[model samples]
Target: MSKRREIETLEIEKIVEKLCLKSNIILRADVLRALKKVCKNETKNPVAKKMLQLLVDNAKIAEKEKIAICQDTGLVTVFIEMGDKVIIRGGNIVDAVNKGVKEAYQKGYFRKSIVIDPIYRVNTGTNTPCIVHLDVVKGNKCKIIVMPKGFGSENKGRISMMNPTSSIETIEQFCVETVKIAGPDACPPYVIGIGLGGTMDFAALLSKRALLRPINLYNSSKHIAKMEKSLEKKINDLKIGIMGLGGISTVLGVNIETASTHIAGLPVAVSISCHALRSASAEI
Candidate 1:
């Protein structure tokens, strides 16, 4: 590979499409194991446990057959960490992404769940024009992380700006309440990502980005890890159970990340991920 890589536009297009298909079709193994582990340890009700088993089985079928587990393929989201020295050659990067999305959905036999106009509600059938976020980093390569944000969980995302005087207890309560309100709608045995101290949208994006971190890893910051553990306990206490059948496992894990903010306000955002938690990353 050339240090001055010339990644073609068509190549990007193809990659996006393939990624969408893969992400929609197969639940990642890490997500599957985490769900099983959380359910086994936290859930108590027999009925919920049974439902969880069904979910596990469903995931297996989706993986084996290469089919989407849910009809909603989700809004395509890309997180790009671009190295400072890397220059993309060939076509427009955005168009390359859209082209990739188009090809993948078509070739992979996945549903195209995008609408052309929000109000008119015209279906774009190809699932083109994915949501892409790019960041420039210090290296000479690019790392692309793809996460398909399904509406079920995405709809339940929450954001708030509290006074500087707001206590951590208040933030904790917000996290728990977000899950309770979402109930079974967002799917259970889910991962919770919390972000603090940013503007509204940035905070929300941070929360979602935090979910991209590996489930097995703990936050590097001791204070953040402690808060994550505490929130996880409180959320599990909700007893929303597996698939909201009402049991002990309301949440699988809570991961919190924070950043400094203005003295006048404390911003918080919470995002949830369903059991599938489909995500993939590659560096090139």
Candidate 2:
């Protein structure tokens, strides 16, 4: 039998709190590099180029000053990959994560954006009860990824159920139309995550998970990589520009994740993440 790895709940909480602070304040290096590259390449649209530059500058300032890149520090979303042989000690995992989130928001002075009730609408204040997705894998370690997702871009995400026979062209069109509809609301210079071939909820979750990938990486499948490139170009062609001001550098990247689905259904989801693109990961 494989040796079991025991992890203290406090250790998880410490890592989660650190991840929240780091992800919010420091934009991922890949994302910052992409924005700078866009600024350099967008020669025709000076306004958009300037906006892109500003974004880069903002990231630099946030990192240097140890402050959030955007005022909306965002709701916490944690993805946990647990090895089958790993054991949690000390306390419940979910409670530990929530405690970590509360500490991060309070100590780091991040905006508490969670609401206790969706309809009645009262602020959670502590940003507790973060969205957690747990997956069991084959290792003896735990890996955690934290994504601070702002609502502006998140609200624009969409999912659709299409016939299994739907062509790539149809899927491409749907993605483009989604971006067009999102427009400025999602904050241009977006990172688009496309999830395909899963159940409706799974598709949406996959799309959100796709955003956690590095901006520089492409889908591993050759066909999917090609489609990702094509989608990126099409999205930039929309001229949404920086903050939707009209330019050639609208989308920084397009990532696609796929899973097996029922023969009768082809569910697709598009998750739009703004330029902030804040996420960080660690393994323990």
Candidate 3:
């Protein structure tokens, strides 16, 4: 029999706390690089070029000062990959993550954006009950990824059910329209994550997960990668510009992840993320 590897709640909390704090303060290197490239190519629209430069400058300031990149800070989202042989001891995993989020928000001075109830709209104050997604895999090591998602771009996400026979052009058109509608509200110079196939909820989840992928990486499948590149060009053609000021550098990257779905439906979800694009990962 394989030996069970014990993982303590305290250990999880410490890792999550640090991940949250670091993710907020430090912009991912790939995203920073993409922003710089966009700035270089945004000469057609002086306003957009200037805005991209400001964003790059902002990231540098945030990193140097060790301060939260955006005032929103955002609600915490944790993705956990657990090994089958791993046994979480000492306390519950959810509790540990929540504790870590609370501590990070307090220590990092991140804004508490979560509400206790959707309708009542009362503030949770501590930002408890972080959104957690867990996937059990075959291994001995546990991996955790934390993404602090601001609603500015998140609220612009959209999901739709399409006929299974929908052509790629249809999918492309839908994505472009979504970006056009999002306009300034979603924040331009966005990272667009496209999730195709799966059920409605799963498609949405896949879109969100796609955002966690490295900005410079493309899907392994040649077809998917081509589609991603095509979508990026189409979205940029919308001329949304930086912060929707009408310029050439509208989208920084486009990522797509698909899963097998029912023959009857093709569910597509688009998740938009702003320039901050904050996330961090650790393995234990």
C-alpha lDDT of all candidate models, in order: 0.80, 0.91, 0.91
- Best model number under TM-score: 2
Clashes of each: 4, 0, 0
Tell me the lDDT of model 3 at 86.
96
Cα-based lDDT at residue 50, candidate 2: 83
List the candidate 3 regions with Cα displacement exceeding 4 Å.
1-3
Cα lDDT tens digits for candidate 1, 96-143: 877777777787777788899989989888886688998988767777
Instruction: Report the lDDT tens digits of candidate 3 across residue range 1-284.
Output: 55679999899999999999999999999999999998998777787788899999999899898889999888888999999999999989999999999999999888999999999999989977799999998877799999999999888999999999999999999998989888877667899988999999999989988999997999999999999999999988888888778877789899999999998999999999988898999999
Candidate 2: residue 63 lDDT (0-100):
91
| Residue 20 alpha-carbon offset, candidate 2, angstroms | 0.2
Regions more than 4 Å wrong, model 1 = 1-5
Worst lDDT run of 10 residues, candidate 1, spans 1-10
Better of 2 and 3 by TM-score: 2
TM-score of each: 0.93, 0.98, 0.97
